[model samples]
Target: MNDRDRAPIDDTRFGAITVRQDGQDRIEVHGEAVPRVTLERDPAAEADPQIAIGTRDRSHLTMRVDGAEVDLLPAKGRLARHSYRVDVEYDGASYRLVPDSVPSSRLTRDGTHLGDFSSDGDETVIAEWREDRELRPADAAIGYALASAFGTGAQPMWMMIADGVSSALP
Candidate 1:
């Protein structure tokens, strides 16, 4: 953990979030007027296109920024909770998104816990990041998708709570 007590956060700014669902298989992530990352499924024919190939669940997800494509590959993770994971590199830094059974997921980089994000099966999502680390909006969006209904084994908060309540009743 970075020293939060030694010094105030030097730079930990969060881009104002606006996550919009364009269709059944698309999510647009925007900060201010510029788009950060657009996560969606690619047409079967162009899935393994010019971009680098991928692995794991083969969800065929396309990660785009301003209509330009970037590699969004899947990786092996705790599949008992989530279907797959996204392990990518940005600015020479490696990031991993791990999904959970609840409506939330974990974000780690270089084996250090960075943050968590969750979605309530709607356009709005919540992202909490470590105060000392820089925030990457793209990671937040991917984690949100993995925690929301868009990904496998993701259940909403209400459903989990109701299940717990019902299970407890005699």
Candidate 2:
């Protein structure tokens, strides 16, 4: 549906956080600030807005916003983990801001490797499912939370998480 009908993101001095429905089962997260970020949303687009992340030559990650694409890249650093950020717009609002640093870790379960990644470093967050499995309790909870926060039906949560992490550069 429209963003106005969804829950409003909490606004802070540094930035604001918002969630809006994309398609029937998709929701988008937007973060924005004055100089560091901007937020926007438009409904007449064909695809959701997106953000791409990686080195100039290698694009390993991406996030789709109101049908557009924004590139996310890591800041220069010697550490194994790097900070990735991007801009996104949807439903008539534009979010042009860098995301906060998210700490990523390698995960493994039952001989299956889930890969190395992290949420936005915020304990209260939701993500989409990527690996092959039915929705886990935690992930399902996240979906429900997101849906409740944005006022939408339950949808995939890991998609947002994967997009947020894969787009980060090493």
Candidate 3:
């Protein structure tokens, strides 16, 4: 665990959030068991010229956090029914979700990819800087995808709920 992981616990305003990989995508948060998930079959299993080469279909990805499950795919519409991959839109920024590999997932925010996560069988490790932010349902959904693809713990994105402060990127 690092300082970023402890901020929420040390500061009650951030609440006590603990995300650690237990098995597969399953995680433990504050002693609560978070469920693991696999990629759902894409409705449009057809080849997508947009997806990176070597990438496979993973339509539905779910992540459980704090007793709540968040689905990364669209909740409604044709894309929800057809596309296995989904992009997240929030605060004017778009987060593109992609399955780089079976044990890796990538989240690209506004063209500048934040980072990627990989599963080590026993734990999840982020390849770049990981920050805590106040996340919405869509944001949380993406977080879960990262956890599932990387087989890591979930990050706390509801900072505002604990302390009315803005930790999101500008």
* C-alpha TM-score for every candidate: 0.57, 0.24, 0.33
- Per-residue CA lDDT of candidate 3, range 1-170, in tens? 65255432221222233344432323343311223222332333453332211123334233333344443443221112123334554446676655454445565667655555444422233333235533333333344444433342222334323433444434
CA lDDT for candidate 2: 0.31
Predicted structure with the largest TM-score when compared to the true one: 1
Q: Which of candidates 2 and 3 reaches a greater TM-score?
A: 3
How would you encode candidate 2's per-residue C-alpha lDDT over 18-83 as one tens digit per residue? 444333233345544311111222333233122211121113333343334444232332222312
List residue ranges in candidate 3 displaced over 4 A: 1-17, 20-84, 120-145, 149-170
lDDT of 1 by residue, 111-133 (tens): 77878765554455666677887
Q: Lowest summed-lDDT stretch of 10 residues in model 1?
A: 2-11
Superposition TM-score, candidate 2 onto the true structure: 0.24
Q: Report lDDT (CA) for all predictions.
A: 0.53, 0.31, 0.38
Error of 2 at 107 (Å): 24
**lDDT rank, highest first?**
1, 3, 2
Clash tally, candidates in order: 0, 47, 2
**Model 3 scores what on Cα lDDT?**
0.38
Q: What is the Å distance of residue 33 in model 3 from its true position? A: 22
Question: How far out, in Å, is residue 94 in model 3?
Answer: 1.2
The residue pairs in collision within model 1 are none
